[model samples]
Target: MKDNKQLAGPRRDTIETFEGHENTILAIATFPDGERIATGSRDKTIRIWRLEDGRETKKWGVKMIIGALVISRDGKQVVSSEGPELGDDEDDDEDKVLSRFYQWQLWVRDAETGRVVAGPLDGHTNSVFALDVSLDGSILASGSADRRVILWDTTTWRRNGDPLLCGAPIACVRFSPAGHGQLGIATDKYIQIWALDRRERLAQIKGHTNYNGSCNLSLSWTRDGARLLSAGNNYDPVIRSWDTSTWEQVGDPWSGHDADQHIYRIILNPAGTLVASASSDNTVRLWQLSTGTEVARYEHSDDVLRVAFSVDGRFVFSGGLDKKISQWEIPDDLLTTARGDPLSGRLKIETTSFNSPHKHQRQASAARGKQKARVYISQSMYILTVNQNLKSHLVVCGFMITTSMFLRHF
Candidate 1:
């Protein structure tokens, strides 16, 4: 066993690995205060940990595989999905209905005690893949493989209205950050913005192609609710942003990532100035929102599935296929350098569709010199340095990092 004091050393941009899950971690979420994190794993358990000291606070053993997880904004409740626990009960017909027909259940539990508070909220006829809570904590939205997005009234813990039929299997759903009654749904290769207040579809934004939308591809909204971001899939691996006001492509598609690097999720910082991308290429990259420049890249042990920015915009957390979670600290000097006049550069839209089309005013040469020397750590033993050139270069050398311990995978 390792000493607890050694694990609580100084904080840096180093890769700190937390190991507890016996299987792949499918979902991860941080509380609003960024002090605690909730993770659901295929190991059939949900565990909570403190951020300051890597200590497990609470854990709950679940019956079925956990597909997704979401915590309320007030940090009072947690919602998770558990597909039907299939079995060989030949006499039970409902078991056949659940196993063959894809019937699943959603559980609402107390965040502090891990006690069931409301569910087995039964309604969806298939596995639930996505879940989110409204900013006001009054409503909860869930998406399922049955091609439905259901809204629930948290006050009474009852279904609010008839299910919204998404044409394809629902991949992801989120409420707009503006706190209005709008919802963003991602299905197939398109993004549909729905106005929940009016109970109708608001707009369907098009232009990039993707294989399928069922991989928990994240859809993020800027804090002001002015724009939305979705990193394209294996078919189209570009990061696309949409102007919510007009629902049009914003400043063409941001592309520079290798074509083979399939993007899994994208997250915007709290300040709404930078976007972090998780990809299959075993790397995470941060892009400047205004200029669409790839600023930094952090490598991982395997394909990254989920990435999130801290509420305070100081650090980013990521977990994926490698069964590990990595936290990286953001440099204040780097953000200070990137923070500039959003209107300093004139933005232009491209008439062409899917093929990469982007245009932006060139950043001054002198500014690049001052923004150099931002370093990032990944899964490899070496270090990854992101210079002012806006490109990632890896150094293949190893060094000893004292006071850092790597937990056993098994």
Candidate 2:
């Protein structure tokens, strides 16, 4: 079952002023209070920004390109790790045998002061690609190219276990929102659930094939802590739901977008009503869980790399290949109604057509598909049908009308 609801919201201008990077921006993290945002760039620096004023808060120097950035649940600490650095063939002579190995480090800093608090966590034998902080804000879990997921005490900066080994580079790690000592870890082709108390694996979920050499897999837990969601870099993007009680797959995979697009990130809203994904196709898509259908798609000039929703669920922030951060406003009325009722009235327009060639005389129609439009009921819905070859001012006028209507209602 797929639910395609009309997204009613303002189309605000995207702020585009960040300096460009040589490579794609990999990850973004916001402070707990929502005032500050930090971005990990392949440019070898972590840029922190003041979201309210749209100003640079600070920039930290890192030696190599960063792969990920994570802020503690309490918002007091920030952690970042670098991607692997390639060694020159001349340096990798077998006879010379000069250690070709590279090590990744996790640097923890105070969020407010922008000062290093703990590391350069010098332990991972390979690039550290994924990181997560526990719900209680006591432990930090990181996954690395070393094929191990290590747990660290936030206060003591010590390893929690012998390092949970997955036999392949760990791509991502997430702490269950339930704060029940449950953690989810993703490697190249498998997802494993571990019990934090015993430091033992509870279950392993396997399905992905043709796993890319780059670690791009993502895993997240629903707010209720009853279901788990996982997605990764494959032709068929799989959004799987797992029952927490029985540790069983509850429903069929929610598949969308062709296999050609690489899904870089998948994030569930704090309320668990919506899931947002960023793709290499240069678009960010929002999906409603109840219907398993995309409700909105926001286009960008470059591939979207990271997206994060505010704790209140009213705004979505995305960072992309263009090296800029964009904030999207979600309609408050829609969010409120959707939470109260899983199925809200949505007005869906299907197959809009124009009756006349004359500009002002044209009449259009909409199918009102399945859901009644609830968020913007009183607002006008504008539809335009045009020929493929037509590139006149009329088309531009029609787009303007639609854009205006969306902003006014949202």
Candidate 3:
């Protein structure tokens, strides 16, 4: 039987666009249930939108540009970072000129009313770049250019531990999905995993150079917490992944991204089979994790900075420099790749061997041209059939047959 692979399409439908921000949207976070979205913008405003109708339900203004945002899992609260002005005019420069007298702040607010609940979470000496809450909602981690990452207890609204002395200015931080008291910190050229429970480094992953100063880059983990994904900056435009079990790069970097454009954000679908990346190249791409192929791409008019998948993984929401949020839908067959994977069971650990790359021996042949493509395809099929020991023989044979047919047709 043929594996259910849909014919590739030229485009994905944009079901709706949310607009209201007067400036570039810098941050976007969706409710865990996917019913609502919260965004922060360079316009110094935050808006909450009902995803169902693309309606802005609440809005609030702040004193400084909003750079990062995160919504609580329950959808009851939101937190956003304050950043430098969107422009560097003399007046803004003068404000920086008097930096000795002022400090920036982060806010935690009621998600529905836009009311500040607790904040000016004041400790960082510089602009806040990233924010993440622990799985149980008791701890919040904030990263800043001040060269520190702080843990704050939600109940006391106070710092939870001594400042994490990351020597370089912090770029981004994310709590591990496993909730095993782990934190992913990206600073300068390294991605460090810190064990919050022990207050020590758990793993130090080195790859992907940093681009600019802004916390525009991001880090995400698969829902299973088995794989971690890192988006690249202008200095490094490839999306790299690491097996959490060993904290090592899984395969050759997923390339084809524009080296000049920074891959601002990356996220995985709820099922963990697809990865969505938003980039300065004016597009959002969905990559098949198993094949490492970019299966779908959606176009945007300007730099696309942020992207979020709906709770159901049915839709993708993106916002950016264009001052608009767009929703995209993938074809059903493409989505089916995620559904009943041997790794997706609720309580079972994903031990599928599909996580490893298929060692292709025809690189030189394929690189030459179509004349050698047929030979390359057959060798690839042989390798797939021989190397896959964990997946069903029928499934592997089906994939090989499908690829053989595609190559013949080509």
**lDDT leader:** 3
1-410: candidate 3 lDDT, tens digit per residue: 11123324255768899989999998888775446788899889999899878899988999888979987645688988885663456655755655822366778999878888998888887777688877656788999878789998877779998988887767788876553667888776578888887789878766575334323267887654677888777767778888988977899778656656788888877555788889887878888877677888787888898888775567888989899999998767776665434342111111232322212223112212222211111232321111111111111111222212321111
Candidate 2, residue 145: the lDDT equals: 69
User: Candidate 2 — which residues are off by over 4 angstroms?
Assistant: 1-22, 87-101, 209-216, 342-410
lDDT of 1 at 164: 85
**TM-score of every model versus the real structure:** 0.74, 0.74, 0.78
Candidate whose TM-score is highest: 3
**Which order, best to worst by lDDT?**
3, 1, 2
Regions of model 3 farther than 4 Å from truth:
1-10, 86-88, 91-95, 98-102, 210-216, 344-410
The root-mean-square deviation over C-alpha atoms between each candidate and the true structure, in angstroms, is 15.4, 15.9, 14.1
* Model 2 lDDT tens row, 29-139: 876554677888877878888766778878877777888899875567788887445553445676433232345688888877769888778778777778887755677
**Once superposed on the true structure, which residue ranges of model 1 sit more than 4 Å away at CA?**
1-13, 84-101, 210-216, 338-410
TM-score of 2: 0.74
User: What's model 3's TM-score?
Assistant: 0.78
Ten consecutive residues with minimal summed lDDT in candidate 1?
A: 357-366
lDDT of 2 at 119: 79
Pairwise TM-score winner, candidates 2 and 3 = 3
lDDT for each residue of candidate 1 in 132-151, tens digit (9 for 90 to 100): 88755677899877888999
